[model samples]
Target: MLCPCRGKLKLLVVSLSFVILFTWLYLLVGNSENGRSLLLSACLVESTEARLLERDVLASRVREVEEENRQIRLQLSQSQGLAAQPVEGNYGNQQWVASADTGPEDAENTAEERANHSECSRSPTAEKCELIHVACVCAGHNASRDVVTLVKSILFHRRNPLHFHFITDTVANQILSTLFQSWMVPSVQVSFYDADELKSEVSWIPNKHYSGIYGLMKLTLTKALPSNLSKVIVLDTDITFATDIAELWAIFRKFTGNQKQVIGLVENQSDWYLGNLWKNHKPWPALGRGFNTGVILLYLERLRRIGWEQMWRLTAERELMSMLSTSLADQDIFNAFIKQNPVLVHQLPCFWNVQLSDHTRSEQCYTEVSDLKVIHWNSPKKLRVKNKHVEFFRNLYLTFLEYDGNLLRRELFGCPSQASSESTVLQHALEELDEDDQCYDFRRERIMVHRVHLYFLQYEYTPTDDGTDITLVAQLSMDRLQMLEAICKHWEGPISLALYMSDAEAQQFLRYAQASEVLKNRKNVGYHIVYKEGQFYPVNLVRNVALRNVNTPYVFLTDVDFLPMYGLYDYLRKSIVQLDMASTKKALVVPAFETLRYRLSFPKSKAELLSMLDMGTLYTFRYHVWTKGHAPTNYAKWRTATTPYKVEWEADFEPYVVVRRDCPEYDHRFVGFGWNKVSHIMELDAQEYDFIVLPNAFMIHMPHAPSFDISKFRSSPSYRYCLTTLKDEFHQDLSRKYGSAALKYLTAQRNI
Candidate 1:
């Protein structure tokens, strides 16, 4: 048993057991403080597997973005190429023929004075060429005609020597050159550039609405023009000049070198890009904002030195092109580049580029018949039948076209035959407009509610065959049950009341209903109380629920505080009976009036309310009148002469509209206060269901002290949150279902 090998093995086993036991004891004690902290540190660092997974996800995203970028670049590249050079038209090269005997020699002093004007001299570059360089793009025959008209307007207003740089096709270039040469004014020098020369450079730019190749011509102004020009004003073909070219040229002095405002432009004015582009993309510096490129002031040398073309190429390479949501081609490209470099642009006032989409005209540009410096007909030009504003601008454009060649004749002599003809045409157009004044009047006719007695009201009262078949729906709190009680007492015939309330209020109202004689045992009256716990007046939803509960064909949507005037029920019953099923499809809207707030007793009848109104004891608030509620354009006249008028698309709160259940139901999206019941009104309007406002019958709105706790709901967080959600949803839903018709009404209200 005492062999050498066996003794050695036994020693080794005992040594290993001792080592394992010691190691276990050390780990157990270390786990309390420093060891525990070390363990947490290890856990905090991501595991190898987790780290790998995260890296993989990030790599995938990069690849996706890269792929999208590559696709857009490919698209942009594919569109680049030179358009074929245009062929010359039938009009061959025609030499300059003087239409006026008076030459530049005769007006040399005047020309020199205008060229040396302070406005031109004050600019950084005062190289006197006696030229006001104005650049425009005219690619087609129609565009060439517009350019002629524009040039005439420019020349007629300014005595200063003018140089027109026209970017056009071969035919337009030839035609326009010939037309300008005929002007025979030595102060005017007309030059032309075939856009095809620059086509290879901007071939990558695709068409987007009006921003196609023609739109992109100004972007490449530096390379397309002679290097001697210091600054140039680029204009759209659709625009007409209202002020002199010299005034527009004066803006060059404001573009300082320190500011590095290489381009001067005005904001787009309309929220088109702001809503579509800016909202989707993150905003940049204060100066980096949306602008309309229709009118621009280009410092030619600065743009060339900046290597704008190279910067544009860099933008494409960086894959910034993918950020665009179509309809914003060149505009998006320009903005993206400017956003990266904010100092390159100077924001001009909105007047410089007066867009047709703008709701109002320029106050600055309103001098005599031509106050605005530039009129940009970007929109409202598509319609043949235009509003008065559009008509005026249209006539102005036509007048310029009519007097395109007459300006030279007038400069030599007195007012020529052409001038008289233009006046005649304008006078005729204006007279036609004068005859159609009512058609052009956009002012909303005000609604007036005059107090009148029951005898003044038109009452065709015959008892209904089915006695009291209408159901009245109201949402109420326990405190306002007395008003409901009053309505029940005064309203004749049978009307089932569907009251929406909270659980606690419902319990209290049920008790009151049991105690009251009018509500307790009357078989004709039904108290249908709907209760929800913790509900903060879901106005439309409650109305919808109540609407479903209604058993009768006709439903009256009213508030608890509404006390119907004398003979209302009788008149309503007879009116409902007289109408056929086809006529009953439309709602019967009875206008409601409010009594004095401090008055304890409600007006017993319309007669009493009228008497109080005349005696100056009670005043009708502004809200009591039956307005063209949330309408874009007023359709029907005010109901001064009419007893009842059908409104296709308007409704008010506590509207007293008796509609069939099948009509467009209340939109449940609307919540408290502001947009409360307007959704239902708009929906009914969109569905072509007319709401007839009844002057014959009305209801009294019994007033109380301003309830701060309740009225303040409009500004409350809950109300605002709900309102934002509902408003967006309402517009989207209507727009999706009914297109622009629904959108028109939804935007008209702007209830949110």
Candidate 2:
């Protein structure tokens, strides 16, 4: 207070110091808050990463468990002895498991059974289940039948797995493929190689054999077959095995230590190789009596190692200089090769191949017919060969011919016992027959003929989600396949097509269908191939094939030539529901009509169809020519009825119907054109199935050239005679099978 200027300076300095202290305190608090936020953010990021890793691990485990469940389910199904239903979405590589029975008492045994089942269920190339490979060259329907007989004999006796490699033409391939596919034998697999692909290899060798160039296909086997095939047993279509083929397969072990031994063959049992069968028999050169090529065990690995192709070609070229052409084709060339390279052949016992050709001295090979391991009908006349023991061998062939191929699909464990029982039955049957009585007489006047159905390109269509679909079942030849697109489009539901054609036609049809815009993309059609085998058209057999394979609850049985009116498929579905058809034994008849004009626009509605009928452009199917065929439909009543109307069955009535899938099958015995459809209707009547005519549904038969059967019926007296005989026998059979019901129908027919 005494000095004013000094006091003021001191007070200002004190105020500046107080302001700096407060600012330092505020900066320290802000730094602490930022450090806490950084620590919290780091913890959250670490925690999130840990949860993500845990989720990934759980997802992986779930996937693994799912896979294990699938495997366990498959194994369990097999263990329960359930029918191996094909796994969906795996059509390219179908796997089938062998059935097994496991007991609760023995856990160890159960484990062993599981392991064995797993082994059996593995792919065809699995190591534990060694496959015995057999190859054959077969073409045409006749050849296909012969091959079936041959395979039947093998299946009847095989103890191990079998894989058949067939060199076949388009027809035989289709037939064999169809038959084998339907067979579904668990222990067997089949593969078909087109014979046309191999023709160029053997075509140049001039062959005068009765079988033509097809016989020469054997020479190309070394190149035709898979390179990985180490060994194979090649058999002729005409051969029948009397014992297990495994015994024949055992011959391959004999080739061991002998590097040159490439083939196991039986010596020829005839004097033809000795050049003594005829006065001017200039046979190909042979070592002694030569060797038969009918039953050959080829060491494919050894043959390839020795360059078999070059060797056979050289041999053929050398032999061709001396001879103009090979009379025996494959047999001649094979014998010539073996003659030059004798060390390459291991001679199989004569009983292994008891040849039954006309000139055969086969009695010297076997003491009795029972001693025969493989019977070879190496003659054009086949069963009528001039052998002294023709009846015994012929009967043996017939036994296999009449064998039910379905039996071959029985479980592997049951095969040996079943085969033994069958053999015993056959022996007893043969003993009871007279020596002069043929087991099967080709000339017998029989109504029913043994025909195979669904011989190729078999497919099963998936049902719609609602399961209220109708399957259109029909039969046709290749020429009629042109109508398939229209039929399929109009139906718009699943179509079960039974195609009857030769092998060449099948190939053509497959190619055409594949290239077609409509046919290729359609998955709703099931094309069941029935090979046109016999002279007369197997119309009923084809119909049955299409009829039997339908997966839907209802089926519309019609011919391929007949086009259903628009909305027929939808109408049938609605009618079935409205009429409660699933619970009834009634057939919904679709009235059929025909037109003489080759190219008429198909009517889309029933009114339009009736208009066409009124204009004389269309008439009831077989109206003037065979009124009896459609008269039972009662068309006059059908036109007036708003709802379905009942019609009394009449003789020779053959109206198309939409019936339950379980309806009486078309009698397959009434083959060809005339009586096929009528017999089916007669059986339906015998079974007491009600014939109800649908008011709206109709079928229009498109005019085409007459079928071969119709043409033959018009031209040949023998054909008509056969038809008459077949009809009589059919009537007798129907009377016997259906008893009083059939007799009543027959009485009504006679009165008519």
Candidate with best TM-score = 2
Q: Over the stretch 1-752, how does candidate 1's per-residue lDDT look in tens digits? A: 01122234444455545545555555564457766566566557879798568657856765665565565444332211000100000011112222155573333222222222212222233323335788988775456645655666777667456678988876566556544543345455667888998988776755455546776666678888898887898887777776666766776766653446677776555555444444464321222236777788888888888888798667644644553332554565566666676567755545456677543333222233333457677774432433356677777666665552433433312212222333344445555544343312111100111110010101123334574366666655455778756777767645545455533444366567668876654444544443332224445555554566455667677777777776676777666766543354677876655666645455565566666767765544334433434231122232242455665554343255777756666664454455656667667677776677665666667766544435756466755664555567677888899877777755555753
Residue pairs clashing, model 2: 170-503, 171-503, 178-455, 178-456
**Pairs of colliding residues, candidate 1:** 79-203, 80-203, 80-204, 365-371, 365-372, 367-371
Off by over 4 Å in 1: 1-130, 257-259, 276-289, 316-320, 324-329, 358-371, 380-388, 409-752
> Candidate 1: what lDDT?
0.55
Per-model TM-score versus the true fold: 0.36, 0.47
Question: How many residue pairs clash (N, CA or C atoms closer than 3 angstroms) in each of the candidate models, in the order given?
Answer: 6, 4
Per-residue lDDT of model 2, residues 528-632, tens digit only? 666544455667767777887778988988888888888888899998888788777888899999999988888877788889989999998988899989988
Candidate 1 residue 287 C-alpha distance from true site, Å: 6.3
Full-model lDDT for every candidate: 0.55, 0.73
Top of the candidates by lDDT: 2
The parts of candidate 2 lying over 4 Å away from their true place are 1-131, 134-178, 181-460, 465-467
